[model samples]
Target: MKRLSDHTDVQLTELFTLGDIDAFEEIYNRYWLKLYSAAYKRIKERATAQEIVQDFFTSFWINREQVKIQTSLQGYLFTSIKYLVLNYKRAQAVRNSYAEILLMVNNSFDNSTEENYNYKELLERVETEVNQLPPKCRNVFELSRKQYKTNKEIAQLMGISEKTVENHLTKALRYLRVNLNSLLLLTFLFLRR
Candidate 1:
């Protein structure tokens, strides 16, 4: 009797596709550690790497029927993990950038009394400017910036298309940029000090 381990990956994959759970188990056992190590090397976070590898396996099983492997299974898994790591890194970068923007906005004024007063005045001006926007544009900008809704979600909520929501946001931003140029310049200079 040939042990499951004696079979090649292609053989095991065929068996797995045929609903042989034992063959799947053997493949999992053979590749799990290697996959984990590959993920760890790229991500450099133990927990995140573990989660990525585990998620890949879960997705692999769930999407097994739809998955068509042209290369070896090992190559396919490695490529999948590589793309996963890249996506994770890209998302992390976006979050980091958002955090930095929030920090800059929040910390624009220091504890100085004059600066604090200026901050209040600036905020009021910004609020007034936002309120002066066209109703749809203001609503879309508020939902996107304050409520943090995606364009698609804003479109659904407003009964408009995503393109319309995008246009509204663009219009609001352009208006604010033109109207509040000096305020933005002051804020930038203040932050630079």
Candidate 2:
């Protein structure tokens, strides 16, 4: 067998497009470190940088057959890393903005007796509504939401089918929405502060 390391980028790409795993591995091994370092420099976070580079390579391999390399493979990979970093930064900004808003609201609520009372009442009302759900529906909803289980996990734990779990969740949500719309609206308003 020919050594993949001896092949040029264009040849590797062609081989990869033709479903050559060795060529694909050669391409990944050739570029992963450079791409990761470039991403890390831009992001300044090791884990996030690693994830971005890993995701790019995964997508590259997955789309190898359809990918159009308008420039050199090096140029294509670098440009892909650049765009991935930009997108990661943009998403991080949005998440930070939301975190700031939540922190501000939580800090404000810390000293407000009226807000605390309203929050307590809202929690009580939610509990009441949840309790009012039919037995199976309540169990499924609690497992899915409170325990944070996936539908499949809930199904396995409860000895029910995933479809049944989904049905219960849908029914529980509809009941809650109808019964607690006002409470939910009030909670939303409080959080919007």
Best by lDDT: 1
Which tens-of-lDDT digit does each residue in 71-94 have in candidate 2?
999999999999878866754553
Candidate 2: where are CA atoms >4 Å away? 118-193
Against the unseen true structure, what C-alpha lDDT does each candidate score?
A: 0.79, 0.79
Cα lDDT over the full model 2: 0.79
Tens digit of per-residue lDDT, candidate 1, span 65-139: 887889998898899989878766754554455456447667776798978877788778888999999898899
Consecutive 10-residue window with the lowest summed lDDT within model 1: 90-99
TM-score of each: 0.63, 0.60
Residue clash pairs of candidate 2: none
Worst 10 residues of 2 by lDDT: 93-102
TM-score of model number 2: 0.60
lDDT of 2 at 100: 64
lDDT of 1 at 6: 89
